[model samples]
Target: MSSEQQSIKPTEKQQILQMFNLLPDVLFWIKDIHSQIEYANTVYLEQVGVKNLEQALGKTDYDFFPPHIAKQFITDDKKVMDGELITDRVELNSDQKGNIAWFLTSKRPIFDEQGNITGSYGITRHLEKNSQVLSDVQAINAPVNFIKENFKSDIKIQQLADVAHLSVSALERRFKKYLMKTPKQFINQTRLEHARRLLVETQLPISEVAYQSGFIEHSYFSKQFRLLFDEQPSEVRNQNQSMNMKV
Candidate 1:
């Protein structure tokens, strides 16, 4: 349960209705049980790109939005209908305006005089500008993905060269120039690092981590961990935990 769940009272419902009337957000006051649009503040009308309150009223998502977006809205509405409230930001296209809108929305169910859920209410805020978090994340992850896709298969220097459309020597040259490592060395290093993370983040047992990290032997994994980091996997895990605690 949340603060909102615990706070709503019957007598305060009308007063709550009045409070939202002047609120700046695109606010919707709804009948919870039937999931109907009962009242919307002025901002809601503006958000829907409509000029009249009457035009926006009595219209659920189906009446006001495209089929795809309306279906998603109804899906989320069902969750609130089931008594768990959710808040999310969704980027969607509006056929009415023929443009993309990003809405930061929060919705919850409302109860009526008989304590029956009459509908749900929500507020929407427009998202602004470009968000590069997705692009940054993809760039950061591209190398790992390349390795994952190529690792288990026929990924020799020649095979990788073909994949890169470069000659073997050129591919090797770029690998060393850009990665500061030869292809084999990079693979070994990646596998070893994966071993370390799995050991630290999970209790899957050392032998399993060894195989999963692309090493055939536990002894080899242990040796590489010590040779590379000057510490065993277990020691690194303990050090990581200690550092996390201090932070």
Candidate 2:
């Protein structure tokens, strides 16, 4: 067995697996080396129309999704088994009624006691609007992608509207209706998420991190960060350092 696998106590494994079941919004599953389902969380079972866990076990994507979608999943499963960690891939899927929905998915390889990859575990986070049209998907992604790419710079709502090919007012309405946030709020959230990661992962001065994350000043950055994460940036960094030292 792989050294890392050997390090995991059976109870620890069970504890982590149980936590997956408790997450109501995320769809989680495990597949065997043969790419057959072995475990599926409650959300996964509900979304895929499986009556029970027993009905889901031993099934593959082909049993729940269209053939084309199944093929894509199978390909990704193989990649995971080959030791790739796939993260945050946006996928289009059909619901039980065959309406298109978008999801952000991730997959990680599961290793045997000897460290050999023996299976996979995955999660999918459903994005907004299960009934979104193909064009709507394109429109939403265009602005979202622009925000991600330009978050370190000053971003204007009108620029986002132009990227999505919608009028300024139309863009605001669509973002609020589908994503439940205004364009500016989404941009701020995105910047804060980046800043949080930087704070935890790097020793950069808070001011520098704030500026890089697109806030005009560290004071504004600290205020917004506290509002979003419920912790001051310094507190998070200190906690991360303490944990690292303990490790």
Candidate 3:
């Protein structure tokens, strides 16, 4: 049994679950190996327009999302069931009202006592269009958007500060306060995220991928990739290739 299943009494488990439901910006859910929704947090119910857990239990993505998006979700779930962990995938999801929002998602397989995969669980954190804890994030939205758009080029901190209409020092302060990263760190993070996607989804040469990811030097790109991922970019490509071959 899992720790929650073993140690927590039913009432206590329910109370802990209620705490998870109160998290405003996160949608959490678990699915069976067949992709049936087993559990969904309160935020998930609100997003899908469900009145209660009963309305969502045993439903699949098809019940909540458009067909195209549902297919993508099932594909990811299948990967998790196959013992692959999917992390930090940025996606645009449409809500019940057809409003689209961006989210950062992650998934991992749930295992049984025998260590066999039983199902999957994951969380998606909303990236936009909600009340932000950092008020300055609203003011810096333009520069953040600009950084995302221009991360593949030679982006400068001064250019970002100018775009945000803040001084260099002021922009650094706000970026750190709102994003928890300095402007340069944010830029590198953006570039690295793009590089990760390209490495997995495309057959581009590593050097070209690095260049397109805004790393002027191949050595520096490799260093940064190792620092963030703890593995060479080549290993990521190799893993993806292996998964593709099996598919």
Candidate 4:
């Protein structure tokens, strides 16, 4: 091949990675040992609210996601780097706008020619496209919807169980089986997510944000928020404000 023609040719790895861009509902990404993103498909970039892959390269999940979500991602990445193959793991992810959604993820370690593990790659499919997987957890739909709609109020496990039309124990078992969390944990998570969004988007006082998010005790709200996100509510708000100023 002529020099110019050879220069224009895509490498084998490039060709394979390009295929992922065509899968609209599937997000694909590769990350280095440190969990820095090395490559991401178009869909992955879009999901993270970046216009192009260049904006995402060299960034870790912490850059584009809430701390709680990023922590889970880092944990999974560590397992993959340690040569554990993660398959069909259900996970919650938030976009740049902090809209949370469920996705099915799989990850595997990438090895170099010398057989040393160098990095990892993962694929995440939006659960809506995977009908069978969605149906498997279909029993929780009512409860899930209830939590989303009523997170601002005092939510109870019995309320969720009634919404799902299952006994409290059965609901807990199903939650553990499908969502990997207890009913109460799910309620708290839903409330915390709401509070985080409010903190980033509104100028409300931290205590008010907690109360509006269903936590009656300010100290308890701060404790759970810090425990889950590794940051105080005021810190989250200030960080977002700084970012907005930069823009």
Candidate 5:
């Protein structure tokens, strides 16, 4: 075995091979943009209507899926190429068996030494167990993650609520119930933390920092900064500079 293969822990290797023995959901692995098969579990053979792994080896997705399915997957594959690591929960009818199914396809790009997108890895799992839990988790985390990442530039409470597909009041209640904080609190906290990171890490001007950190007004930014830190932005910067000089 190669060093990578040799590094697999004994328990992990057993567990991984155990997953392969399952026949309900197929696991596929592809390396490179060509979608060539790297490895497949025993479940893949049953689902793909193939008799053995030998029959499934060395094939591209084009060999498995029809032109339409192949085209759509190819498009989504290029999305990872564009630096999106995504896990899509979708429902579909299998072309092989014409059975309607619901599953999630999760994939992220693997990068080369210089950070070029080299290949991708993904797992597909059936949504048979605990659909409600999955739904609740998505409903709770999706909006928070989005607003946390894109809190800048005129984000209203209503917009974040709308993203959750909940009423303004209902969204507030959900945040309070699940997160123990109001939506506005979450927004402010996210912005404040992000601003602190940028202030300490980057050489950007304070005015630009305010704008980029999701504060529309410099005065409001300063007031909040002092409220949070008990010091002015200049003081924060000068302290950081002195610390760096000492090091």
Candidate 6:
């Protein structure tokens, strides 16, 4: 081989990872046991708002994602590292501009030569570009849209089922099949996401945020918020204020 050709040969791992960059709709990433990013494809980097690998390395999801979203990611990472394989898990992801979207993700634990766990890797496919998956879930669109539009109001599972033109049982089955969450869970998630946005964007009191987000009981809202985000509602507001002051 010529000297230049020999110098440019890609290693097997490099060749494999490089191929992922060619898949425009897929975000590929690897992370350590600590949930620190080790490597990511170009698409993943762009989604996380980082310019390059150097900027992404060693950063946890908390650095790039909203706290609740990052908590979900890290929880999955922990499960994978504990030897569970997560397949085609439907979840929400947000971009740099805070535009949220649904994504289908699968993750597996990476093993060393001796069969010892080293870290984890995963691929996330953007659902918007996946026509097949989207078509399969088209039946649920009506209910999903209704939830988004009416999350600030009292929502019930029966209401969602009615909107989807399905019986409550059938709606529950379809939600579990396609979204991996029950109708009730989806309703709360939508409301919590709205509450989170209001908390960050407005100076309203925490109780007011909860009320405006359709949460009737302030104590219940705080409990669920902490369960999902791994912190109290006040903490999120305090952190946001601290960040603003530093700017």
Best by lDDT: 6
In model 3, the runs with Cα more than 4 Å from the true position are 1-26, 30-38, 42-134
The TM-score obtained by model 3 is 0.61
lDDT of 3 by residue, 1-247 (tens): 7887767687786787678687888889989999998888999899888999999999998688654356458778987898778776654456546764456788999998999888999988877745553243466777888987898888888898899898999999987776667889888987886787788778999999999899989999999988866678898789778867997
The best candidate by TM-score is 6
Q: Write the per-residue lDDT of candidate 5 for residues 88-204, one digit (tens) a residue.
A: 544333534675444567777768899998777666766544476346545556577677668886678888877888899989887776555788877876676567656667778
**Lowest summed lDDT over 10 consecutive residues: which window, candidate 1?**
133-142
Report every candidate's CA lDDT: 0.62, 0.80, 0.80, 0.85, 0.67, 0.86
TM per candidate comes to 0.42, 0.52, 0.61, 0.72, 0.44, 0.76
lDDT of 5: 0.67
Q: What order do you get sorting by TM-score, best first?
A: 6, 4, 3, 2, 5, 1
Point out the worst 10-residue segment of candidate 3 by lDDT: 129-138
The residue-level lDDT of candidate 3 at 62 comes to 69
Full ranking by lDDT = 6, 4, 2, 3, 5, 1
Q: What TM-score, to 2 decimals, does candidate 4 have?
A: 0.72
Task: Point out the higher-scoring one by TM-score: 3 or 5.
Answer: 3
Which ten-residue region of model 6 has the weakest summed lDDT? 92-101
Candidate 2 lDDT for residue 140: 77
Clash pairs for candidate 6: none
Q: Write the per-residue lDDT of candidate 4 for residues 92-201, one digit (tens) a residue.
A: 66643667667888999999999998899999998878888888767788898898889888888899988889999999999999988898888898899788878876
RMSD of each: 17.9, 15.3, 7.9, 5.1, 15.4, 4.4
The true-versus-predicted C-alpha distance at residue 197 of model 1, in Å, is 41
| Selected candidate, larger lDDT, 1 vs 4 | 4
